[model samples]
Target: MAGKAPYIVPVGPIHPALKEPVHIELTVVGEEVISADFTPGQTHRGIEWMGLSRNPVQIVHLTDRICGICGVTHSLAFARAVEQIADITVPERGDYVRTIIAEFERIQSHLLWAGVAAHELGFDTLFYLAWRVREEAMDAIEVITGNRVNYDIIQIGGTRRDITEDQYDKIRKCLNTYKDLFSKLKKLFLEDAVIKSRCVGTGLLSFETAMAYSAVGPTSRASGVTADLRVDYPYCAYGDLDIKPIMPTIYGSDVNGDTYDRIVVRIFEVAQSVEIIETCLDNMPPGPVIWEEKVAKILSTCKKASGEAVGRHEAPRGEAVHYVAMDGAEAPISWKVKASSYSNLHVWPIILKGAQLADIPVIVASVDPCLSCTDRVAVTDNGSTKIFTKEQLAKMSYEKSRRMMQ
Candidate 1:
């Protein structure tokens, strides 16, 4: 056993457990993982590059495609940046609508991840149950935005759609269902012997390591790091609500920062999100959903705007930021995105050390990573870096389309 050699084991680029294409390389001695690393650019689609040619109005819709699950996250962040540069003040009702949608996104995302984690652990019943319950949140989202996925509700100044009084009854009905099922969910995930045995002490990330590595969302909160952007720096209706970071302590357990704690944090967060949406509905102010209703007027304001600003939102995974710079143009001169996964992915090597090979799937799924949202590509030709301009990229894309047609 002492003389056993460590060998590399690669997982993905394609795998059943991974929802996206990411290659994870593990160096293992027998069943114990000695070291691990991951590569993330396999699914990069040049979204930021594409935005260079589009105006803020057009680009906002494109942002919705960055991640299928976080429908409003990217659009909201991008719109906020444009709003700041254009000096647009969102109507009070718009902010409340934004907050409600964002919390609903959190509810669906956490539930989806829970199902994935359960499936990774071979708990098919739980997996099916978790996904079945998640439909309620999806229905609620559709009721508000008119689409279940890739909701194009956000716009530059504010929201494109408003929550009508008639819609409030259905949303509240969904909330009431979750509130009733909260205890059963807690029992199923936290009290089950199989889940507890498999997750209690595995894939540990200490508080210091989480902070040092800049972990975010439930990943950091599980480690007892009070780093929620919603609480630390409120935006939209979050400032008006009594929001607090959900920790393992909320589950009546000390912070272990293990896979189990991550589950605890997310389950409790669903309750927190419910409370937020209900509060927003009860006190939603009366006003326009968007600052400028006409696309021509919004575009004109953006074109005249000349400044730089960063928009940050507490996404389901963590803090998602969009940086935009404009100089009296239809399109922003510069745009960049930093998804929450970018901050949490680096801790893989630390957390994976000494974990059993069989536990790798659940450990990886515990982070609730969305690699498609975080991936960015750097082109290199003949060993030298190549940075393509918007025109060059467009030409190449057109050529590729022509070739495909042939």
Candidate 2:
């Protein structure tokens, strides 16, 4: 028994357990993971190719579909890149609106992650608790942008809508509700026996390893890497505030970069987003929300412009960026999207090495893996495929998380 060999177990491609298809091969002895290799890009949508085929206006909408949760950041990054090339300055009001939407989206995303993480730990009550609290932010966003998931708000020059006095009141009320709930939720994640026992020592990623992998967003922050795109490269209304990256140390944790630390970092981030939203609403100036060009005019204008630029955003997962090149054509000559998961995914092998088999889902969900957003990539895979829908993936993720509780 002592001389028995480890076995290679495959965990994806057509696997129903993930939100998107990713094949993770594990070298394990008994139930303990010895090493791991991950292969992603299963849900490639050819978004970058799509961006090149359509006008910039169309790409704005297309980018929103990159990941339903992180769509606003996608639109924000693409719009900023196009604005840089076109030499356009967004209005003060537009910047404020963008900031508000961005923060609101962050709240929604972080809460969604929290719920998923909780579900992964087999704590469905907390999953429902986190999402129930998440609804306030969603409601606030729906009021501002008219849709919950993909706001369709950000444009090249500005946003599609602005906040009114009555709407601001509604948003403020929603914010108040979130603020009240965060304190309680924070205690639950940090102190609850079930969450702490399951997550605290699991999926450890060191600061050095995180830096080597170039991890972004809460993943890096939990490891004490203060590399937020908003702070390093200010865009949108992010320049309005002096941002500080939240770390697990802030919430009474050593910077272990474990699943619990990741949860703590997100909890702190939710509070930060609330503060940013308030500040943005307070200082917003009245002006045009977007450039006064119609859809047809936008395409014509794009066709006359030629340049190359990059735009980056602090997506909920990490740093989401887009590289854009225009060549005096209605459509882009070249466009590349780099979602946050692309960099963060590299840390998987390190974190999953010493984990147990049951910890696989917990560790993977710890990074908030968004394979769909990361899909429009250049890596080629000649592997076989499967037919798995988004709903099946969600169900699988939930079932796995619930099982982890056992």
Best-fitting candidate, scored by lDDT: 1
- The pairs that clash in candidate 2 are 120-401
Q: Between which residue pairs do clashes occur in model 1?
A: none
Q: How many Å off is the CA of 32 in candidate 2? A: 0.9
Candidate 2's residue-wise lDDT over 238-283, tens digit each? Answer: 8879778888878765788899899998898999999999998888
Which 10 consecutive residues of model 1 have the lowest summed lDDT? Answer: 385-394
User: Candidate 1 lDDT, tens digit per residue, 1-406?
Assistant: 4999999999998999899999999999999999999988998898888798899999998999999999789999999898999999999899999999999999999999999999999999999999999999999999999999998999888898999999999999999999999999999999999999999999999999999999998999999999888889888888898888999999899999999999999999999999999999999999899999999999999999999999999999999999999999888899999999999999889889989999999999999999989998867788898888778978989999999999
lDDT of 1: 0.93
How many Å off is the CA of 355 in candidate 1?
A: 0.5
As a TM-score, model 1 comes out at 0.97
